[model samples]
Target chain A: MTTNFSRFEGTEDYIVSEDLRNSVNVAVALSKPLLLKGEPGTGKTLLAQSIAKALGLQLIIWNIKSTTKAQDGLYVYDTVQRLYDTQFGNKDVSDIKQYIKLGKLGEAFTSEQQVVLLIDEIDKADLEFPNDLLWELDVMNFHIPETSETITAKNRPIVIITSNAEKELPDPFLRRCIFHYISFPEADMMEQIIKVHYPDLENTLLNEALKAFYWIRSQHNLHKKPSTSELLDWVQALSAGGISPDHIYQELPFLGTLLKKNQDFDTILRRVHNRGTGENQQTGTRIFRNW
Target chain B: MFINFFYLLKREGVPVSITEWMTLMEALSKGMAASSLTSFYYLARAILVKSETNFDKYDLAFSKYFQGIETPAQISDQVLNWLENSLPPLDMNIDLEERLKYQLENLDLNELKKTFEERLKEQKAEHHGGSKWVGTGGTSPFGHSGYHPGGIRVGGASLRRSAVKVAGERKYYEFRGDETLGVRQFEVALRKLRQFTTRLEGPKDLLDLDTTISETCNNAGKLKLVWTRPSKNSVKVILLMDSGGSMGPYYRLCNQLFTAVNKTTQFKSMEIYYFHNCVYDQLYLTPTCRQSESIKTEEFLRTHNSDHKLIFVGDATMAPSELTEVNGIIDWGMTNDEPGLTWLERLAHHFPHNVWLNPVAETYWESSSSYTIQLIKKVFPMFELTVDGLEQAVKKLKVRQ
Candidate 1:
C-alpha cells in the first residue's frame, strides 16, 4: 500500500530548499525518524518544532546529556523514592507504577494522535545508548519491568533526531534513520532569513551587514564562525540601536553579537581596524589587493 | 536497480544491512520519495545509513556510483566573482620576452625578496593586465591572480604551485581532537592490551546468571548468585601530540587515533597534551591555552610514574634546528642550551616504555631528507601510524615484560 502524506505542513517562512523538502517528505511518508546534522545554531533543533507546528502535532523533546541513558527517553523508575516511601511510612505504596514516570519517548508513543518526537543531540549520550535504542525504535514498543506492562505506539511519532557531530553514532543506530545535513545558508538565503526574522530591515543595511558577515566568515583564523542566528541577532541589535549600515566600520562594539570567541573578536577587530585606518575603500569592496 | 547501490555502499565500509536495503526498496516502491536522483540519494541515505559517523563514507560512495548529484562546494561563486575586481584585458603585444626568460632556478630567494620590496614601492594604483607592474593576469614576478612562474603569491588563491613564499592573512581552525576513528581495526589493535580481572563490587556489577544457575542446581535449587564487575586495564598512556604547522596534514588521522585510544577499555589513565612543532619548555592541556599557563615540562616528568607508557604522536618532520639548535622554537622566543633532543632523551631515559607513532610513512622518513626524524628516531623507536604499526607497538610494550 502506498503511504500518502502529501499535505504540505511546512510554511513559506520555513524556507526549505528542494533537497530538505524531499528529505522531510520521505521521512513523513515512511514514518521513519529523520537525522539532521549541522553546525551549532544552524537550526537542527528548530526544524523539529517547525515541522511539528506545521503538521499540527504535539512536540515531545528529549534533550540528551552525557549521562543520559537510553532507558531515560522511554521511562524512569523511581526505585529510591519507592524504597524511601516504604521505609518512612507515609502511605501504603505497594504499586511501583505510582513512582513510574513516562518519558518523552513514552509520551510520544502512547499519544492517540500523531506526535513529533525530537531526540536532540543524541551524540551526547553514552556510546551504547544509540545501540540500546535500536530495538525500541525499530519495534516502536518498550517493556516496562516496573509496571509489568509494554508501551506500544498507538500512532507512530514522527521522530526527528539532531546531532552537532560531537561524537560518532553507532552504525546500527544510523542504519535505521534517514540522514540529512542542513547546510549553512548562503548570502541570498541569509537575506531571505533576515527578511523573515526582521521584515522592516532596510535593503542597503541588510546587504552591508551580510557582506561584512561573509567576509569575517571567510577569514581562516576564527575559532567559531558567526551562525545565521547570530547574524539575525546582530541585525536586531543594529535596528534597535538605529545604527545605519554605512557606519558599521565605525561601530565596533556591536561586533560582540557576531563574534563569541575572544580570539575571533580580536582577530576581526584588528582586521577591521586596519582596513578602517589604512584604506578608505568601500565596505562592500573585496579586501584582496591582488584579486 | 537499487541493489547495486546497496552493495556499493557496503563495499565502501558503510555497514548497510539487507533488512535496511529492503526497507529502502519498500519506501521507493510506495512512492514515498520523489523519482529524482537527489531524492533517491536522500531516501537511500536515510534508510541505509544507521549512524552519523558513516555519513561521509555514504556520501563518498553515493557520489562514486551516481556522478554529479552532490551540490558544489558551499562557498558561492558570487563571492569569488565579486572578489575578482574588474581588470584591463591582457595586452599580448607588450614585449616581455626578456623579463619572462628569467628562470626560477637562477633567481635567489633573498634577491627576489629585495626586488619585491623595490616593486612594492614603485607600484602606485592597482594595475591589471600589464607586464611591467605587479597585478593580475599578466607575467608579474609578484602579486597573485596572475601568470607568475616562481614568483611570490602576494594575495588571492594559489593558481600555480610555484610560489617562493605566500604572504596573506590565512585563518586556521584548530583541529577537533574528538573525531571518531571509524575503522574497528584500530579498536581491535587497541584491545591487545586488555588485561581484565574480576572485581567483587562496582556500579555496574554484572550478575553471572549462568554460574548462579549451575551453583543453585548443585545446591538443590537454592539461589546462589555470582556478581562481578568488569576490571579496567592497568596501563596508563601519556599522549603528547604535535599540533599546528606541518602537523596540520595529519590532524584528522591524529584526532582519530587520540579518540580511539581514549575510548579503548585498555587504558586505566590517558592524559593528552598539545605541543607545536617541537616539545619545548611546556605543553598545553588544550590547544587554545596560552603558552605561559602551560604545564612545565620538568613538572610533567616529575609527576608521571615510570610505568606509564609515553606515546609521541607527531610526524617528527621539522627544521633540524628545531630539534638540535639552541633557541630553535619557531613560535616561542625563549632559548634553551639543552636543546629539544636532550629533553626527549631525558624523557625516554626515565620512561623505558615509549613509542613514537608517526603518521608520515616510514619510507618518507629517509626519502624526504628529514634530519629531525633521524634525531627523533635516535631518542625513541618510531612506528608508522597505522593499524599494523599500532599492533606492533602494543606488542613491543608487552615484550618488555
Candidate 2:
C-alpha cells in the first residue's frame, strides 16, 4: 500500500512545527484520519486547508454544530421535497435517488480526484456523532436504506478532524485515527507566524509587541488569554495605527484586539498599571495611563 | 521492532492498542519515519497516542526505552575511566570493580536518566540532597556524589544526545488533566446532563417521517407530510454553591464550573444560588452572599419543580453546631429558626434528584472528622468535585427517583 503521494510540508500561509508536519505526513501516508486538537486559534482548521493547498487536492469542510448528526455529513433524503413534488404534480417523484442529496462527506468521497475532508470542530456535535461516523470513515463508504445503495469512495479523501477539546471523543472513534495536539507556538515560531500575516512588519515593533503579548499570556489570573489570531490582529492594528515601538509596550494600543473578555482586559490592565507605576518611580516618567 | 517499547508505554499509563501499533508498523515499513529517530518518535506518538493527555507518558516511555539502550554502553566507558583514574589507592582495596558491577546491575537506568534530567534542570548550584539531585558530599545521583550506585558524575566529558534532550523537555505537562480542569473539560463533563425530550406539543419544525408515511397511505394516493418539533435537552438544573471563607481555595474551581454550566447550551434552564457554609432559610444570588441578593428558600422550592437536578457545591467542613443547632448560621446578622441540616433535607426532599459536590478530596471524606459533612452526606449523595466525580454525579442526576 506504499503509494507515491507528495508529502504535505504545510502551505506558505501556515507555519507548521516539525512534529506537526511529521504527524500530518504519517497520517496521509497511512490513509487514516488525522485528529487535530489544540487551544482555540492554534490553526487546527487552517491545517486542513493548508494540506489541501499543499497537496493540490480539493477541500471539503463539514462545519459541525450542536444539532449536527453524523448521517447529515453523508447524505440527506429530502422526503419533504419529494412530497411537495408529488402534491404539485410537476415531475416524476418515483426516483428516490433524485431527492437524495450528497453532503460534505459524500461529496468528498464521490470527488473524481482526492480531496481534504475537514470535519471541523467535531466536538461541537453531540457526543455520539463521532461514533455514528466510525463505520463510514473506516471503510470510506456508507449505505442508504431508502435507495438500497452503497456509496463507496471513488478516492478515499484525506480526513482531517479538528477538535476544540469540548467533548471527549469516544475511544473507538479515536482508535481509528492519527492524533496530534498542536501546542501554542513559542516566541520564535510566533515571529514566523506574524511575518506570514504581516510580511513587512517592523522588527522593533514586532519584538516589543511580542514581548508584551507573551507577558500578558503568562498571567495566571486571566480568564481568557489572547491566542495567535488575536496577536495577528493586534499587530495589524499596530501597523495600521502607526504606533511607535516605544509606545507599543507602554501604551498597549488597541489591547481590545487581543484580550476579548472584560475580566482578562482588567487583569492585564491592573498588572500593567502596577508595573508602569514602578517604572515611573524609577524613571520619573508616566509610561502608562489607565485605559 | 520496538515491541518492548509498546509494553513500556502501556506500563507508563498510555493506552496503546494493537490496532494502533499495527498502523505504526505499517507506517514504519512505508518509510514514513524516514529512518530518523526523532521522526520515529513523532510518528509513533501520532499513531499510538490518541490524546495529548497521554503525550507526557509516551515521552517518558520513549525516553526510558531508548535511553536505557544507550545508557549502559556509555556508562561502561565512563565507569572504566573513573575506575582507572578517579579511584583513590586506599579505596581500591575493597574490590571496586565488583562493587561497581553489583551497583550497575541493581540500578534502574530509567530512574537514573529521569533523575539526572530533573537534577540538571533544577540544580542551580551545589547543594546537599539524598541521592536525588546533582551535588557533592551526599548520595546525590549526579556530580561526584559520595557512594551512590546510579550517580552520573557532572563536569566529566560526555556526548550530548538529542533524543534524551527531546524527552527531557516534557512540553505536554501543561495538557495533563490531573491538575485543575479547564472550562472546556468541565463543559464536556456537564454535557452528560443533557436529557433530550421530544415534546409532542410546541412548534412543529422537524418532519415526522413515520407519521408522514402513514398519513400518505390513509390519504389514498395523495401525498402528506407530518411536521413535529425535534427532541431537545429538557434537563433543568438548580446549582447551590457554598461561597466565602474555606471555599476561597476552590473559588477558581467553582468559577470554572459555573462558567462551564453557563456556557453549556444543552440544559433547558439553569438557576444558580450562593450560600455561605451551608444553606439556611435564604439563598444568595451572588457569591458575596449579601442580604440584598437574597432569595427565600421556601419561595425557591415552591417556584421550581422537583424535575430540576439540584447540585450543591461545598467543602462541607464547618462547626457541627452550624448544621445542628438553631441560629447556627455563620453570618453575624443572619438568624435561622431551623438548623442548616433541616434546610438541606428540605431542599433534597423537594428535588428528588439532588447531589452534593465536595471540593475537598474524596480520600479526606472517608476519614473526615467534620460532623457537618457526615450530616449533609445523609441528605444528598456526596461526590468530590473532579472530572470523574462530576461525570458520576451527572449520571446519578439523570437516573429516575
Candidate 3:
C-alpha cells in the first residue's frame, strides 16, 4: 500500500510528526487493539476514520454515551419495537422475530464485510464499558442469539477505539491498548491554519490578530477561552466585512465566531480599551506592560 | 487540618478563584466517606490549588498542603498481621459474603450459563427445526443474537420448508418443553468463561491464551498476536489541549476540535492532566481541580521511558519561559524553582520523543511562529496534525529503533 494518507478516503492530510505517523500506520494494518490516549483534539477518532478509508473497509461507528452498558457495544435488542410488532403483526408469530433489529455490535458481528469499528469517545462510557470488548476483539467473533449463530469475523474489522483521558480507565483496560500521540500544532502551522481560514486577510491585520492571540494566551487569568475554530471565526469576521479591531471589540460575544465565556470577551475588552488595539490604528501594536 | 489545595494551585499561576474552590469543596463534603483515592485526591485539590501548564508547582503545593492525607492509619505488628492473615468479622458494608451475594444477585451468572449451554446443545444437535428451542410456544430463547422461534434466520427463510419438514419428523424428539417430564438431559454443563475471565486467573492467564493460539498460528505459519498496555496513560499524559486563548488567529477552531476530542473515551484513559498559560511545571487540572503534580519526574521517567509521548496541543507562540519556568508564567514566589520552561525541559528529557502539532496552517512555520517552531525542534519532532504531520510521525517512529 502507498501509505499516503490522501489515498485514504474521508481523510484529509492528518499531518502528524514522524512517530505518530508510523504508529498510525501500524495501528491501521493490524487487528491488534489500539489504545490511543492524549490531550483532547489530538485526532484520535480521525485516525480511525482515516484507517477505514485507507482500507476499503466498512466504517462502523458506535458513539458511546455515559449510560452505555457493557451490552451496548456488543448487540442491542430493540424490545419496544419487537414487542410492538409481537402484539400487532404476528400472524405467524415468526414475523415478530424478524423485527428485532440488532444494535451496532450485533450488526458488526453479522456483517460479512471487512470493517473498521470506531468506538468513538469511549472514555465517556462507564468504567466497565471496555470489559465486554476485550473478549470480542480478542476472539474476533461473537455468538449471535437471534439465529443461534456465532458470527465470527472471517476477517475482522480494524477496531479503533478512542478515549479522551477524562478519567483513568481500569488497569486491565489500559493494558489492552497500543499507545501513541497527537500533540497540538506549533505556531507556524497555526498561522497557516489562519491563512487557510481567512484567505483574504491583509498581512498587517493578520499579523496584528496573530500577535494579539498569542499575547492573550499568556494572560494567566480567564475562564474558558477561544480555540482554533474560534480564531478562524474572528479572522473571517475581520477579513470579510473589513471589520477592524473596533468591530471585534464591540460586536463580539455576539459574533458567534469569537468566544464562549464572558471572561474571554472581557479579556478582549481589556486589551482593546487599554492599548487601543483596533483596526485602522497605527501598527495595532498592543503595548501591554504586564502581558 | 484540611485545607483548600487551591492555594497550591496559585503557585502554578492558575487563575482559579475562590468561587470555584467553594463549589469544589461543596461537591467534596457532600460525598459519603472518600471511597475512591482518585476522587479524594481531586476533592482536596478543588479546595485550594490552581495552575495550568506547570505540573511541578501543583505537586510542590499539594505536598506542602495535603501531605500524609492519603496514608492509611499506622497499625501495630500483631493487629496488622491479623488483618493481613485472617478475614475480618462480617460487616454489612465490608463483608466478603455480602459482596459475593451482591455479585450473584446482580449478575445471575448461573442463569446466563444455562442459556449459553442450552444454545450450544441445540447447535450441536444440528436441530434447526421449527420446534421451539427453549421455552413456551416454540419461541426463541435467543434474543437479538438468536434465531427465529422456529430456529430459522429470516434470510434462511427460503430453506424453512426443509426445516419444517425436518421439524415435523422430530417434534417428538426435542420438544420436551416441560422440564419436569424426565427427558435425558446432558449431565454436563457448558465450560465456564472462567477460562477467559481475567480476574479468575491473573496476567499469566493472558500468556496462556497467547501461547495456546501461538501454537495454532505457528502450525499454520500465521502470526501470533498478544495484547498489552500503553507505557503512558498511568504516566502523566499532560495534555496541552488548546482552550481558546490568544495564541494566533487559529485559536478558536483548535479549541473546539480539542474540546470534541476531550469528549471522547480513548483520550480519558491516560492521566488527562491539562495546562493553560504556556506549558510549565505548575499546571492546574480544572477551574475547580486545584491539585498540582510534582512526583519525582526523573524517578518517574527512569521507569516511564522516553517513548512516553508528550502531546502539546497549544499554538506554542508565547515566550519560552512560560513553558520553561515559574517566574515566566507569573509563578508568584511559591518556590525558588523555575516554573515555566524548566517544566518542558524535564518533560523532554523524560520523554525525548514528544511532538507538537499546530492546528494552524503550514505557511505560518516562519518568523511569526518562531517560538512554537523553536520549542518543537528541541527534544522531539514538530508538525501539524495535517497530512504532513501524520507522515512525519510515521517517519520518526520507524527510525526510533
Candidate 4:
C-alpha cells in the first residue's frame, strides 16, 4: 500500500498507511488528551511530536518518571522554597505572593494557540497519574489552591500520551482517548528511515546493516528490541565506522547500538555464528516494512 | 555531551536553573551517558526546557547573553567530564534481614518459630488462650479491620482483600487480569476490524460497503471521522482453553487472543471450557471453572449452529487416546492416551470450524510428545498462538469461507 507520510517532515521519507496516517492525524486533531500504548521505542512520543509539527503547533512534552505525580506533572509549587522566602528571602509573606510556576502540563494549558502536549512513557509513572488527570483533562483546566485561581487551556492542545505497556493502566483512563499500538516498522520503511537520516551511505552497506538489524530482532528473545530510531542510530554508527554487514557477524558490539538486553546480545552473538537456524534462510537480502 | 550541554547553556546566557542542572545530574547518575548524544539532547531538553516556547527563549537568550562562551558542539565533552566529576554519589545499599528469615525459606525449626513469634509480638497479635472458648469472649488483639474486606487501590484498580494478613505477607501478587498476551495482541489486530464491520451492501468486498465519508472544506484542520458500522458475526461457538500447568507461562497470550476474538468475532454466544493435563471433552471457565457435559460430546457438537467455529485455544500437548477415539469422544476408560495423544486429534476432527492456536513457538511443534498434536496439526495448522497467529487464523477462515 502507498502512503502520504511525506506530509510529515524532518525524517527519512517513507510510505505510511492511510489508516495509520489517519490514526496519527486523528491523534493530532484530538490533541485533546489521547493515550497511546505500544512496544518500547516504537516511536510513540516521536509520533506525538510529529503530529504537533505537522499541525504547525508548539509541542510540549513531559517524559514521565517512575516517581512522577499528578501535581508534579503540572507546575510544581515550590511550597518549601516559598515558605523559606516568606521566612527568609527578604520578602515578607504579603510581598511574597504565591505564584504557580508553570510545569510541562501547566505550560501546555497556558499556551496562546493550539499545541501538542506529549506525555512520553506514561507507563513509567504511577497508573493513578493518568486517572488523576481524567477530570483536569476532560475539563482542560486546573486550580491553584495557593492563589485560588483556576488555570485552563487557551486552545485545547491535542494531547498524545504514550505508554510502553509495562503495566496495565485503568480502563477509564484509556477510554478517554483513541488508542493505537504500533508494531516494529516494516523493513522498507525502516530502510527509508535510514536513507533519510544518512544520505551519503551506500545502498549495499545500508542493506547489510539492515539485514543485521532484522536478523538480530528475529533471532533474539530479548526484553528490549531495537526501535526505528535505534535502527537509524545503528545505520549511522555502522556508516561512520565503515562497518560492513559482511563484517557485522564478526562485530557483535555494533549490534549493541540496536539492542539493549544481554540475552538479546547473546542471541545476536549466536546468530552471527549461525546457531539456531530457521528454514526461511537469512535472505541476506529481504525487503518488507511498508505502511 | 548532553551532560555538558547545560554548561554550554549557562555560558550562553540561558539561565538553566540549578534544578534543571540537577535533573541532568540525576539522569547522568542513573547511567544516561554522554556518549549517547542523540537521546542526550532530548533528555536535557526535557529536563531544562519542556516546551517549544522555552526552546526559542533559551536559544535567543544564549546568543546575546553568553556574549562569547564557545560553541556547544565543540566543548560538550569537556563540560560533560566536569559535570560527571561533580554531582552527588548515589548510595545503593541492600538489607533483607526480614526476607532472609521467613518460613518460606527452608530455615531450621527454631529459627522459623522464633521469627514467627517475633513477627506476632511486633504486630501485638496474640491468640486468646491458644484457641477461643465458646462462652468466654477471648478478644482478638489484632481486631476488627484484619479480616474485613478493606478495598486497597492497586494500579488504579481497587481490589477488596482480607485485612488479617501480615504487612509483609500482604505483598504485591502478580495482578494477572483476564488480559493475556494473545488477547492484547488480538485487540490491536482487530482494531482493523472496523474495516470489516460495514454491511455487505452488494457483491463487492469490505471497502465498497462503507462509501459514506464526509470531507469538509476549509483551512481549519484535516477532517477526521470514525467508522460507523459494528462488525459482529452471530455464530455460536465452543472453545476449550488448555489450562495445562506447563502452558501457564503462555496463558496470558492464550487469553488475549480469545479476548480479541470475543470482541471482533460475531459469534452468537461464546461458551468456553478449561481442561488441564488432559481434555475429557469437559471444559471449565475458572480455576474453579469446570463443566462436565451431561449431554454426550457428540450430541453437543451436532446441536446448534453446525456451522459453529470450533475454536480450541490450547497448546495441543496432551496424550493421544482421548483423540484417536474412533468409537467415541474419549477413551478415558483405557489408560488416558497410552498409545499416543489420539484424544487431541479427535478434538480437531470434531470441530470443522476448529482452529488450534498454540502460544508455543511454531518451531517447537516438532518436539511435542503426543502424536495427537502432530496429527491434529494436519487438520488445524499448529500456529504460534500470538497476535500475528490469530490474524493469520482469521485470514485462513476468511479464505475457507
Error of 4 at B166 (Å): 55
Off by over 4 Å in 4: A1-17, A95-99, A249-253, A275-291, B1-401
- lDDT string for model 2 (B1-401, tens) is 88999898989889889999899888888877767777788889999998888888887788678755333323333333332333211122256547655766788766777766655555554454344544443444454424455555543322222122465345677666544476757877898788778973579898898898899899995877788899988989999998758887887888888888887877888989998888988989987777888999899988998999999999999888889989988888678899888988898888999899998988777565866787888889999898889999999998753
The regions of model 2 sitting more than 4 angstroms off are A1-6, A279-291, B69-164, B179-202, B209-221, B243-264, B287-293, B332-334, B352-370, B381-401
Instruction: Kindly list the per-residue Cα lDDT of model 4 for residues B254-348, writing each as its tens digit.
Output: 65666555554334467776665445444445543333423334455566444556656676665454455443333234243222244455555
DockQ-wise, the better of 1 and 2 is: 2
> After superposing candidate 3, which stretches have Cα over 4 Å from the reference?
A1-14, A38-43, A54-57, A80-91, A95-99, A194-206, A244-256, A271-291, B1-401
**B50 in model 3: Cα distance from truth in Å?**
25
TM-score list, all predictions: 0.67, 0.79, 0.38, 0.41
Q: What class would a CAPRI assessor give candidate 4's docking?
A: incorrect
lDDT at position A122, candidate 3: 81
Best by lDDT: 2
Tens-digit lDDT string for candidate 1 (B1-401): 65787788888777788778878888878876556555566667667765444666677677667642123322233323432673543344334545555654477765666676666666556666655456666776665566655676555555564662311211111221223345345666777865555642456566676786688689775555566576657777788888756776787788778777776645777899987767877888875435655998889988997988888888888788888888887665567676788888888887888888999988888875888898898888899999889888887765442
Residue B168 shift from truth in candidate 1, angstroms: 33
Residue pairs in collision within model 2: B131-B139
| Models sorted by DockQ, best on top | 2, 1, 4, 3
True contacts kept of each: 0.46, 0.63, 0.00, 0.00
Regions of candidate 1 where Cα sits further than 4 Å from its true position? A1-3, A88-93, A249-253, A277-291, B2-17, B34-38, B45-237, B242-251, B258-297, B307-309, B316-345, B361-383, B387-401
